[model samples]
Target: MSKKKDNLPNPFNEQPLGGLLKSIDGFFQNAFQNFQFVGGFPVYEYETETHYIIEAELPGVKKEQINLDIYSNQIKISVESSEVIEEKDDKHHVYKSSNSFQRAERYIILPFTISQKDVKASYRNGLLKIMIPNKKKRIEIE
Candidate 1:
């Protein structure tokens, strides 16, 4: 009686798709590294007979962190934030700290020119409201 022993690599233990998956994951991670999740807030624009109104919803933003600029026919809004985190361990005599800063800006163009003096802005409840007087003059039919 003779016994034949065959040695073959097990296919189940080999991960053929592992490298592909890792490459795909790395590609996506690198692609999205510069993508901003909070690029800008939601803005609503409307006009009445006398004025134009703009409302922006900025959650978790402080009023002092917002800057508004009015041009002849455009409005620019800028928001900036800074955060600091520190951790200390008395027993290990270790201290760690980190700081991060973020800034976002948006621009809105108007159909007509606007006076900077007539523009008014207010922030309340994380909402920024801007009012600009309309410069268009209505003509009467003769």
Candidate 2:
């Protein structure tokens, strides 16, 4: 009886649903691991004893259009930008395009507590840099 129980057939192993589920799972795994879908937002982060440095790329965005919300250990940044493109083909056809996009957001999570009020950010040359101060205070002992 024990031998018969151990040899019982596995239903999923003989079904097409198992392969379909595996194919779906693999497609998503490859997409996430390739990092192509979210390739527009490139970030570089490093940690120090007193501060966390984060640099990101936001091309053609102005400082006034950017927003930042800081939490104990998370950083959220968003921006909106627009552009107007106009072209004339010789003397015949004229094309004009006005495109607007909102909510280019990048959220970062860290292990250390950061000061919300003291966070500093600077933007120049299509690059944005931020420095987050550690909440843990250092006491100087003489």
Q: Provide the overall lDDT of each model, using Cα atoms, as 2-decimal numbers.
A: 0.79, 0.70
**TM-score attained by model 2:** 0.53
Q: Write candidate 2's Cα lDDT for 23-124 as tens digits.
A: 567655643342222435787998789777899887766788777888878888777554443545767565434343335678899777677678899999
In the range 67-105, model 1's lDDT, one tens digit per residue, is 998888999998887666577999979775655567788
User: Any runs in candidate 2 off by more than 4 Å, and if so which?
Assistant: 1-39, 83-99, 135-142
Error of 2 at 124 (Å): 1.8
Summing lDDT over every window of 10 consecutive residues in candidate 1, give the lowest-scoring window.
29-38
Q: After superposition, how far is residue 141 of candidate 1 from its true place, in Å?
A: 7.1
Worst 10 residues of 2 by lDDT: 30-39
Best by lDDT: 1
- Find the number of clashing residue pairs for candidate 2: 0
